[model samples]
Target chain A: MQPNKITGIGLLTAAGVGCEENYCNFTARNSGICKVTRFELPTAKVKTDFAGLIKSLPNEALPPELLQMLNSDDLAQDYVKAAVYVTAEAIKDAGAAEKISSDPRRTGLIVASSLGNFLNVSELVKDYFMKELYKITSLIHGMNSYLPSRLGSMFGVAGPCYFVSSSCTSALNAILQADTLIKSGIVDRMLVCAVDVCLETGTFHLWNKIRVLSHRNESPQTACRPYCKTRDGIVVSEAAGCFVIERADAVGARGHATIRGIGMANGASDFLKPSPELLEAAIREALALAQTPSDKIDFIAGSASGSPHCDHMESEAICRIFGARAREIPLFPYKSFLGSTFGTQALSEGAFAIKTMNDNLVPEPLNIFERDERVAANAYYKAADYSSYHINNTLFVNYGFAGNHMAVVLEKC
Target chain B: MSKPKITREELIEKIVAAIKKVSGISIAPEKYGDNLFALGLDSIKAIQVVNMLEDELDLMIDDAHLPKFTSINAIAAHFDSLNK
Candidate 1:
């Protein structure tokens, strides 16, 4: 069913601190991945060197009390605080905050993350080494350590404060949930946040074991090479993204960003394997929701993580769904610079694509030297001046671990 | 007399390496008896350690007994005692 359109979206990512900066970087085709400096890693298979780390915060830039909560020692707490702050920004951007504040009961929050405050938990766990494990309070908060409750408490959002953790699909699923709530008239407005922080050990070793991490120790800047034949694997990164979604009428009354449509589906394949059928289904669902034909979708923002298996499945899916038009539709893969921050990557990239649509141009994919022939035969990939194109319609696609696929359609409003 | 089979010191070195590989923590051999949970090793990492040990020493420790075998010393001793 069609829900209310998203009226406003605010984002903080590695490309920049907010929507404006992220757009600027995207338009310029700037890469955010760089040598890791947050922590030390000596024995990593790939250098613990590259990531799309968010270096700034909105509260700090805007100077607000909300920023203080985010700056707390607890990283998970900081993520919630950041989510609330960004939601407020989106509301203000939508011009619906005063109305939302008036009827707090009508508002809700859905935050998603794969690795919440893992760094904070690691520190606390380290602290327990010095103290007694049993002595640690039951309320000890760390990375995903009860982020949903914390977000609810901070924002005074009373309805449906929940966290969705579907690995990389977490954020997109959160958005899907928010859309459902708004369409069902369960809430007038919903704030969706996706946040994650770097954990030193478990996270690091997991990737090392899989050997899907980039080992370009010398050139961290170019480490993430999505869609490139030489692409080794994805670099892990961290950031928090949030947006405020409300009914089109509500947003029209306040003049916020408009949401055209959102679609989600799961692959029936093995949890770790990608499935073309599911990917096509997700794209079709999004197109159906947008009520726009495939030809109208000017560009496709891909969830290409540079894995051979994932790229193959996604390429096949695009070819199947769009047919000849797929070749004409410009394809963009932004994850090479952003690194896959679990599920939040999709939310942030989707937001970027929406902004690009607003600008009437499609953002270029970074570090892609060659396009898959299947996709190339069905899609276009190259650096072109966005100004020359009319990106009235765009599709944002993301895939998550365990075969979760999501697609969202955006149109110039 | 037969050499004291796999002395505590020898076991500590093996445990430390395995833990480092699985949990990504670098701890001294002297710290083997320390509670791993308190040291930030989660359930996932604990499982990794058990798997590593099983592969290294050919032991088939049951998953049900993981919690009781929290420390490196505990895991090593549990394996050692089983063979004894």
Candidate 2:
């Protein structure tokens, strides 16, 4: 099968909006996590009032008529509007907005969302329990398919539309699906968008019950320390990322990064803890498909979201794949810089991979006071502005809830 | 004990406050005569206004009556009829 190329990428994160802004923040080691001021954390039971919230959503980028197509209160949802803004940004970056509109049948849209417009869902549940359901104008507004369908309508993309929901690995899985469609010749191009909004009070309370969220209310920015001895848990965050993937020869210009291979594995045993064997299986599958040796990988964009068990599981998997050389290879857990954006993370980290390839430097993991002893992989903790690093390829991993593991290999074009 | 009754002017004032709270834009004394929908009060914002007024006045305004709330005076008249 012919390879697929990531021609353009658009990112909306707490770190910054757009590719340039996010890359600048990454190089400077700036964490976008901060104390929550968007909504009230009413219950004292919920631990931390901290999150990575996009300071200013690009709502102004969304025209009123575009939102009117939803015909409901979905226009009030940040996640919905964010998907459109980032998609437009990606298509514009690809320089194919007009081309996409002209060939609508050949362009597919796939959206990955973990919570699926939970703020609206929360409001609907509240009204239902309060016996105020009569106030709801549209009942289907909070469905998972709402985003991709509405986006397809707004962007004039009508081919092979789908919504993938796999928690943290959602976006990476979406990328894998996009690669499949392109390789199978189902479509000439595909737009993959992932978004999650976890800042709402109801959502915060629900995640707090999971007991895997960080409680570093005093030090919000340094809360998420993946693979470190002091690592606690993920810092919930909200973000959206969009990517335009097309056939390698189809693009007029050279693309950002070429998709060498993608791999997926499920442990099928546990819901919370992942098996190292499965994780290794995913990474090895990707390496095998790419026909690239493990040593060819310059660095790893790890899926360590600060949870001790999850980080250790990934570390074990890395050791199994690279053996003792895992300690020598740099592992950059990019989530340390942007918190755990959940669904949007894999795509955001994919953007980071492209940036590293273009800028020729890997960034240091933030807030790693001391690395865990048992975790064998070298958690990169130095200035990585190496022009001579020969950074050509990267292995990006995403470990999701319910034993879902996905790995993707990206090569410099 | 039940709350005391409110005059039509006071009702209009409360409705304006609810509109401002929901829509984030203040309805001027002159624009009170203009259609709320024309002023960008969609169904969501309208429901929010009704909810805020329900909390402030301790009454339930069924959404069946939502369309009757076109202008500030119209909302005031509707509320007065409901109380009557």
Candidate 3:
């Protein structure tokens, strides 16, 4: 059950830049949702009004050399910038920057983004189709594959590098792959980074057309009511989380997180429609991998981000796994504070879980005015239940589009 | 193909404009001597600058030659050798 340890973590969310800022924001419990100001929303067309869109990390937050390279890549997509920022932060946080800087063979890179350079796709389409002689290369820069390869090239990590796209579960999948590589002795260290700059005109409208995004336009902050009776649907966001992971036996890391168990599955569930059976199966597999039972899980974390079906299915799955004991475990759907960041949700949630588990602070549920009737019966969490609580063994479950389900177990070492 | 960008000044204009277009940064005509990276130039923007220059001027700027062309002055120098 022992796996590679997560030495360093760098998170960039609407909560703010850096791990501490994100944790403070999560613990302080403030909503990062706002009406589209970074890019105007299609008020005339889509009902979805607001999203947590962050265009760039603060200049100070980005590594100086990486920032310069980004500014130089006039065509550098947001995904690339995010990947670079978090990768640098993680290496620095892990104190592995100097160690790995000398030996490219010791390290590898993995970057995941659900919708890679989606916003830039609009510009690319215009360049290719509209213009008589378009800049063809513009389209090439936005593709997903460039993300990790670029980071590897930048950091001189020659071990293994590529992209993983599994919709919302991408971050988990990235970490899962990193864990596999390390355990297999293929690489001693890995930079696992995931980003989704969700505010692209091309991609957002697609979600809007599908009507999965929230239309609580007037009240953007209270819009995404996950697991609440008044829940509507997901309020999209832009964010990224990066980690420096190494074999537990390899490095004396700063904050260590061993991958006790990880499981993922997919079935005949339709695209956009989550499969609860598959989710539960994934959780069971993860628990089995960790060699731990359900009763040992101190708390659970997931984003019941007002996707009624997903919330309902997740509730059923949790009840099935924990039974009446579910009432004793606190289900923290912290995305109620930050809008649902598509691919990086679980990673950001994992960051929160690490902070919560270490600090033993169970942050209050944000804006859960009234728990859903089904959630009330099966799970234990309410607005009134907000206060500091204990955390140890934690379970994180995430589902991507197209029935892609993932569950991971993290234990305090 | 696109009139073979005739002069270094002309090439610099295109490169500077490319920089502005790609990164949303505006460069002062006088700041050509300044390092573009120091002024917020990144790898993506560098590729864009190369792409724009290559396409418009019908000039082939090697990726290896990119680091040498760190500023407007440095890029103009590259264009100078290519032109000659």
lDDT of 2 by residue, A355-406 (tens): 8776667665678998688788878546444436767888898887777888
Worst 10 residues of 2 chain A by lDDT: A380-389
Q: List ranges where model 1 is wrong by over 4 Å.
A: A44-48, A56-63, A67-78, A133-145, A253-257, A267-269, A377-380, B1-84
Model 3: per-residue lDDT, tens digit, A172-274?
9988999999888888888888888857665666666554666678888788787887766778888888888888776644455667889988864256677
DockQ of all predictions against the true structure, Cα-based: 0.03, 0.01, 0.01
Tell me the TM-score that candidate 3 gets on chain A alone. Answer: 0.93
Model 3 misplaced regions, further than 4 Å: A58-61, A74-76, A252-254, A376-389, B1-84
lDDT of model 3 at position B34: 94
**How many steric clashes between backbone atoms does each model show?**
13, 0, 17
Clashing pairs in 2: none
Per-residue accuracy of model 1 over B3-74 as CA lDDT, tens digit each: 336666666677788888876899876777789878767655676776676656655564445558788888
Better of 1 and 3 by lDDT: 3
Q: Looking at model 1 chain B, which ten-residue stretch has the lowest summed lDDT?
A: B58-67
Lowest-scoring 10 consecutive residues by lDDT in candidate 1 chain A? A134-143
lDDT of 3 by residue, B1-84 (tens): 334437777777777888988888999988889988789875555766766776676665543455587789988888878877
Q: Pick the TM-score winner.
A: 2
